[model samples]
Target chain A: MTLSPTERSTIRRGAARARTDRADLHAILDAGLVCHLGVQIDGSPRVLPTAYGRDGDTLYAHGSTGARSLREAAEEPAVCVAVTLVDGIVYARSLFHHSVNYRSAVIHARARAVTDPDETWRALQVITDHLAPGSWEHARHPNRKELAATAVIAVDLGEASVKVRDGGAVDEPEDVEAATAWAGVLPLRWSWGEPEPAPDLPPGAEVPRHVRGRGVR
Target chain B: MTLSPTERSTIRRGAARARTDRADLHAILDAGLVCHLGVQIDGSPRVLPTAYGRDGDTLYAHGSTGARSLREAAEEPAVCVAVTLVDGIVYARSLFHHSVNYRSAVIHARARAVTDPDETWRALQVITDHLAPGSWEHARHPNRKELAATAVIAVDLGEASVKVRDGGAVDEPEDVEAATAWAGVLPLRWSWGEPEPAPDLPPGAEVPRHVRGRGVR
Candidate 1:
């Protein structure tokens, strides 16, 4: 469908991607395991892909204490969290006109370090499980010493917007036939492959049902 | 291999896979066609993904004069360019330890608007063709009116870093066997699918060989 400027977040050039909505936001977030943490470090901007978890309007991210991004976010006033899923490659007649149809959300807000031990402990679980469904329950819990060395930051989802692009390419009617260049989309997607067992596992550790059966969303 | 603090950037409680570097950076950027352009908007952060081109040490981005991001970047002192590529799922024995290995590049730099018509025209061609490989030659050249409304921004590529993680899950030796969870990476990759011709094309418009046989970089 044709998207107008008004529908696309008040930004004239950005298409609102009318087919997408808020629930699409949740599915995109939940279906993926990583996000790029965009923050300014020492006045320079950086985008780092890290593990993230979302609980309603707030999203939590954590990393090593010594990491530059985590340290900066903990001390800074705010940061931007961007999550994107490239659904397909939208190829057009002209090379200059190629684009990707995708679903993405950018969240801009203040982030604060979780200093309370109880909160940090809980946040870590959310983060771990966000990465894998049952891994948190099966893995070793963090000890006091290990917990003390980590940096965890939480950002509310107040100032955010989702931009998505889907469907076949939209070519100008006038140029349709004269456009001799093959003008269509080459769809792109990611999917799970056969499971590979860990090298150190005993010879016959059968693949867990939940993981072996897991498919890309 | 286990990455040490000195080798990979660290976060306090973040996982080992979160640490990434230069190889990861370029791979991510080259794998995709566009990136999120983050600039200060209304005294806060605004991010919009637009078409971009990379020439070794410099990044070029351009859009219609009607596009707000180009206009804002032209006026702002600095902007952030980020490219992120998610390769595949890294499923580990413990849910808490599950991660996605990716490559990302974040550039923090001052941006300059290309006011010269000659430069603007060429940059537009670069940006256009970057999106569509051979389109510049096929599409109608921009008329003076169209040219008058275009905006181009140049970002110097310096002081940027690339981080990446690849291969299998790293788990404690003891948990290796007891970890009943299926533990191996589902190798992920991006490739071009068969092209779909524009529905409006003439009855016998042959797909250009350059566009048809090309593989996604």
Candidate 2:
């Protein structure tokens, strides 16, 4: 299914960078670990970065029960969530043409506070799996008190937009003809380094294969 | 100078993670390539990722003149900007303790639309230098038409809060005593890859030393 852009979700500026395919939206959301949530509080807009997870078309975000942003998001009429990944820096022959190659997804929806016990449990697991591939089974689940202290909010990905810019810089014809300056892309690389064990762990506690073999692009 | 957190800038949840040092805020902003701008449009919050630059205590963000978010931010009473850098993933023996090591700065201010020509030129250079360390002097500067087509806004760093989370997971004593599960951190590494020259560049156009030696953490 393709995305049906609403009046507010449609991309206006740089329309060529917008993607309508639902798969593109899903790909951007799945690859990101954190999302910046925009919500209105006291008639002012506030943005906060928080962990997020995706299950099909619904996006899940959680925070402490006392987080004002999450609380406002649940009560507010609408909220915006943005996930961005910087792929590279596009260096052009002219300053005006310089840009960043990136993939970003923005969702606009009315956030619903997840209070259903079963759904909350599933959402938490989805979040854990998103952050650490196989930690749900390996780690001890949240106890009753812990669960009560957390707040989960779900927003549908129905009204969303995805934008992607890749490859080298797009410079002006005149600038390219001059050839006096170098122009290209400086690729940004993200990787997972060696895992450092917690200080309290006993000696020789094996690092799980799930984390050791996990690949980050 | 220390950050004097205002009523809205003060962090309530996880107050321990909040840093009062202005240097911490500057470091987080300097290390980031993009920032999420939050603005209220039509009584709903909108969050968009955009390139930004910092000159001392002033934060500048620019976009096309026709951009609606930038327009709203200039007209709105208040806006929030957030820059976040994820350092690593903190894996804990219990799901409740799982967290992310990150440095984030959130700024709340009334964005002033830059109308002065001199300030606009300076802001553009600051943004260019922030994205491509040495591109301002190497590349052709923005012409009059290019300058006219851009919109720049400046927001002070006066009402800002910085939050940082580093090191390993903080888990319960009971979970540590059990010691059945592996717990630690998976460091996230960011680096700049070899430059990919633009397709239109002539053969043997040397890459500048500034571009070659630029380091990203």
Candidate 3:
């Protein structure tokens, strides 16, 4: 649970409450395979949750071949990318003190647009496979038209902070002795269920073992 | 599940995908509440998740009286407040294309620091009750210094947006027949479990019915 300082935020509260070790950040990111991009467009902010993948210290995101917003994000450079996983709710004796124990990572940095067709195509594959292992090989690869319509943006791993809250609720010592109310944590969990194949598939298309063998914490 | 246009994001893809009605900007704010504030501090960006509540279209956040960051947030006119809920994961055949179904609201506006003692106390109650319903009445209210140390920041709900993705993955027609990879949704849920009492209690305090009741979706 202890992480080196570089993976930590400078603000004491921001760092203490939310710890982002490499393992912790990667686990949270890999579990859901999606992220929300906070963009301040013309001083107006917008949060766009989309599919994303981390390669080393760079996070990669791709948009539909013709998506204008993402294209603009690539052009803008400065943006905030946030990803979170809610582990549970902290229920305390006092209502004013309830909280959620969650794991999250936020990157505040400029992104560079990946314009090379080859790099974009490979990045797309890396992103796709990150979401589903063994997927790029199973599905048809995008053609030239698809490549032309897409935009890829990469945000560096620097200037990032990770925060996490886990375990039971922390209550005031006096509140512990007072017979007034209950205090504890209500755990939250995410699980992968049995795979359901597309209804219109050819009869012989059985689900792959890797696809069905999901990992849940 | 359809919500008024005001409840949805103007950018289309950013709107809530589930219970659009409950997904309305105000409704999401009114529901069991807390928000994460993202700010750029000391050359790094940090997102701090904390307790919050709403009055009309304005969102108020209250932090520990000794919290310097909250004080700084209050001193400023606008800050970024984001509330997000993950509903499920969209496991598609292609790895690069995996997505999540979620409901989220983001507000980027100047927050006027509320300095009136009475307003600060009221904001505390709203934040407290928002975390655990009916507990504020039973818990000890903040006294003078605690009140002084606390900071309350109210951000206007304008210049905001909500985005979401729901249901099963939308696969390509041809991929549906050949994907052989399974396709479906693994629903994500947030639930409150039975409460655990503080260990040193006088041994007779039972959890209140409302505190023990199941959370609403």
Candidate 4:
């Protein structure tokens, strides 16, 4: 299935870089841990970086009930959620062509506040599992009070655009032929470092296999 | 000098995590490579990840003149720029306490379109240098056409907020004492991989020391 890009979701600036495949959108969203949520507040636009999770075609973002951005998002006519993953820095012979090889997804929707208990519980698990792969099963579930204090907002992925630039620098023919400057890509590598056990943990507690197995990519 | 948080800049939900130090704001902004630019378009909020640079108390963001977000930001009364650096993933005995160790700065300001030639040139250099430490000097400078095709916007950092969370999980006393689940932090390590020279580069062209010396932290 292809993404049904609405007028707002269409990419006009770099139209060639926009991807229409639904799988591309899902891949970009799944790889990101945090998304910048944009919502109108007091007649101005505000963006906040918050944790998020994806379940099929719906993206879930949760925050404390007191968060003004979340509250405003729930009430706003539409909100924008953008997830960007910078894969590498593209170096061109000319400074004007310097760019970052990245995959970015921007979704526009009227986010619905999730109030159903069962859905909230599932959304919380999806969020936890996204951040820490196995934590949802190992960690204690959210208590009643904790659940009540959190606000979950769901954004549909139907109206979204995914743009990706993965290739090396695209420089002018003259600059490429001159070749006076070095041009290439410096890939950005993200990995999980050695786990630092909680300071108050009992002495002999070992880092679980789930954590240890999350080796460097 | 401490950051003078305006009514909107004041972080209400995570009050304790809100930082008042001016140095903290600069540090977080300098450490990030990309920032999420938020602006209202057609009465709806839109967020896009874009390149930015800082000069003292001002932040400059630039994009192609054809970009809609930049045009709207220049006309809007206010826009929010958010930079976030995730340091680690915090795991807690309880899902409710799980968090991310991050340093984030959000600036709210009226972005001014940079029209002065000299200021635009300097801003472009600042932005280029920020992304590729020494590229401004090594690469060919932008000519008249390139300069005219770019749109630069400057935002004052007078009204901003910085929030940081660096420690381990803060779990309930009961969960900590119970010790049924492993609790700790998985630091997110970002590094520069081996530079892949451009395929079109002359065979003998060597990677510059400035690019090679960007070693893993």
Candidate 5:
């Protein structure tokens, strides 16, 4: 299903770079490990990085119940969650044409404060599995008290927009032909390195296949 | 000088992870490639990933002059600039303890619209140097019309907060001893791949040393 762009979600200047494919949005979100969440504090805006997980069409962000920002986000104005994967820095023959090649998904919605125990448990599991894949099955799950202190905010994906800029920069007619400038893309890549074991691990501890495979990334 | 945290900039939840050193904030900001800029639109929050440049304690974000968000930010309530680097994914013996090792800097302030020609040129140079080093010197500089079409927003770094989380996950003593879970941190690394030249490039054009050396990273 494609995302329905609202009047607010439309790309004003660079309309060609905007995407409507829901799958593309999900791909960008899944490829990214962190998201910047925006919550209004008082009359101003505050943006912070946090971990997020998606289950079907719903996105989840959790923090300690005592978090002031999270509490404000759940109660008042709608929050914004943005996940961006920068592919490369585009160099054009002309300075005005230079841009970054990126895939970005932006969602605007008021996240529901998850209160039901079952939903909260499910959301945590989804978040855990999203951030660390094998650990949910391998590690101990959250108990009663742990759940009590955590707050989960669930935002529907209905109101969202995806913008992507790929390939080489577009330069003007004269500059494109006249200049001998080195113009292209410097691709950026994200890779997972070897897992470093905790300092307190006992002797003969094994690096599980989950860590070895770099699952869920 | 260190950052003077206001009531909003104070880290209420993870005080241990918050750093007041202004140098730390600059370092975190310098190392990041993209920042999520948040601006409130019509009472709802909107967050989008944008490229930025830092000169001294001032950060600059540029966009099309016709951009609505940029105009609003220059006129109304303050904007938030957040840069986050995911260092690693921490897996603990217990699921609740799972977390990510990251360094993030968030700045909250009003952004001024730069209209002066000299300041706009300087701001563009700072931004270009930050994204692709040596390009400002290599490529043709912006002409009159190009500068007129671009809008630059300058934000101060006074009311900023830096939160860093590193090392292994902290699991409960009982869970660590009893559970046989593989606990460790899966490190994430970002690197530049070989530069891909523009499709319209001449046959024998050379890749500049700046690109070869991965400058400004």
Candidate 6:
């Protein structure tokens, strides 16, 4: 399904980067580990970086119930959540054309607080597994006390848009021909280093396969 | 000088992670390559991931004048710019305590469009140097036409807050002791791979030293 771009979700600038395919939206969101949740608090804008997960067309975001933005989203969720993957830094012949190659998914939705306990449980599991692939089964699940402190908000992917900027820089014709400076892309890679175990952990514990495998991406 | 956290800038939630030093805010902002610019567009929230630069107590963001959010910011700069660096994933004994170790700086200010040509040049330079350390000197500088197409917004760092979460998981007493699950952190690192030259670049155009040095970070 192609995302239906409303007046709010429409890409006004750099229309070339805007994508319509819903699959592209999901792919960009899935590849990202964090999202910036945008909401208004007392007439002021606030953007907080948080972990998110996608379950089909719904995006799930969880935070402490005590969070002001979460509470505001629950009350009135005309919110924007953006996930961006910075792929590379493009160096152009002229500084004017220097840009970053990135894939960003922005969703405009009325995020409703997940009220059903079962759904909350499932949403938390999805969020956990999204961050750490096998952690939901490997680690201890959230108990009642933890559940009470958490608030999960869900936003439909109906009004979402994906924008991607790739390839090398686009310098002006004259600058490209006249300039002697180097022009290329410095691609950014997200890598994982050796895992550091908790100091309190008992001796002889091993890093699980799921934890080790997540490094490739 | 320390950041003056107004009512809007104060970190109400997770106050334990809130930082007071202005230098800390600078360090966090400097270490990041992109900032999530948040604003209310037609009374609905919107957050766009864009590159930003820090110059002492002021942050600079540039975009096309045609962007709706940039225009809104120009009119009333009550904007929230967020920069986050995710250091690692904290695996806890219980799902309740799972979190990401990160450093995030959120600035709340009225971002005014830089109309002064001299200031715009400097601001662009700061931005270019922040993204690509030596590009400003090595690459061709922007001509007048290119400068006219860009809109640079400057936000004072006076009303910003830094929040950092580090170290191990904070599990409940029982969960920490009773749980036999693997508990630690999976550290995330940003690594730069071999620089891929643009297809149009002539052969044997060597990668500059500045580009090579940036990889260490």
Q: Provide interface RMSD per model, one decimal.
A: 3.2, 0.8, 3.5, 0.8, 1.1, 1.2
Tens digit of lDDT per residue, candidate 3, span B52-140?
87766667887765665576666544467777776666666544345666667666677778888777777777776666666677666
- Residue B54 accuracy (lDDT) in model 6: 85
What are the clash counts of all predictions, listed in order? 28, 0, 20, 0, 0, 2
lDDT of 1: 0.67
The sequence of per-residue lDDT tens digits that candidate 4 reaches over residues A1-217 is 9989778888998899999999999999889989999999999899989999999999999999988789889998999999999898888899999999999999989999999989999899888878888998898989989998999999988899899998898999999888778899999989888899988989898999888887542
**Tens digit of lDDT per residue, candidate 5, span A1-217?**
8898898888877888888889988888788888888988888898968888899899998999999887888886588999998888898887778889999899988878999988998899888878888778999888889988898999888888899999997888788788658889989887889989988888879888888898434
Per-model lDDT = 0.67, 0.92, 0.65, 0.91, 0.87, 0.87
lDDT of 4 by residue, B75-187 (tens): 99999999999999999999999999999999999999999999999999889878888898899899999998999999999999899998899999999888899898999
lDDT of 2 by residue, A8-106 (tens): 888998899999999999999889989999999888899989998999999999999998889889999899999999999999999999999999999
| Model 1 agreement with the true structure over A1-217: per-residue lDDT tens digits | 1222232244345545533355656677777667777666655555666788877667889877777777787677767777777766666654334567787777777888889988787788888767665656655666566687678998876555667787776765554656545566666656666776667766787777656666667
Pairs with backbone N, CA or C atoms under 3 Å apart (clashes), candidate 6: B77-B110, B77-B111
- All candidates' chain B TM-scores are 0.83, 0.98, 0.85, 0.97, 0.97, 0.96
Can you give the lDDT of residue B181 in candidate 2? 82
DockQ per candidate: 0.41, 0.91, 0.37, 0.88, 0.84, 0.81
Question: Where does candidate 2 stray beyond 4 Å?
Answer: none
How well is each residue in B1-217 modelled by candidate 5, as lDDT tens digits? 7789899899988899999999999999889898888998898888968888999999998998898888888986689999998999998998888899999899999989998888898999999989888888888889989888899999999999999999887989997788578788999887888899988888888889877788434
Q: TM-scores of the first chain across all predictions?
A: 0.87, 0.98, 0.89, 0.96, 0.96, 0.96
Best by TM-score: 2
Residues A61-82, candidate 6: write the lDDT tens digits. 9999998878788787599999
TM-score of each model, in listed order: 0.82, 0.99, 0.80, 0.98, 0.98, 0.97
Candidate with the greatest lDDT versus the true structure: 2
Give, for candidate 2 chain B, the lowest lDDT window spanning 10 residues: B208-217
In angstroms, the error of model 1 at B39 is 2.3
Displacement of the residue B8 alpha carbon in candidate 2, Å: 1.2
Model 6 interface DockQ = 0.81
The reply for model 6, stretches above 4 Å from the true place, is none
lDDT of 3 at A94: 55
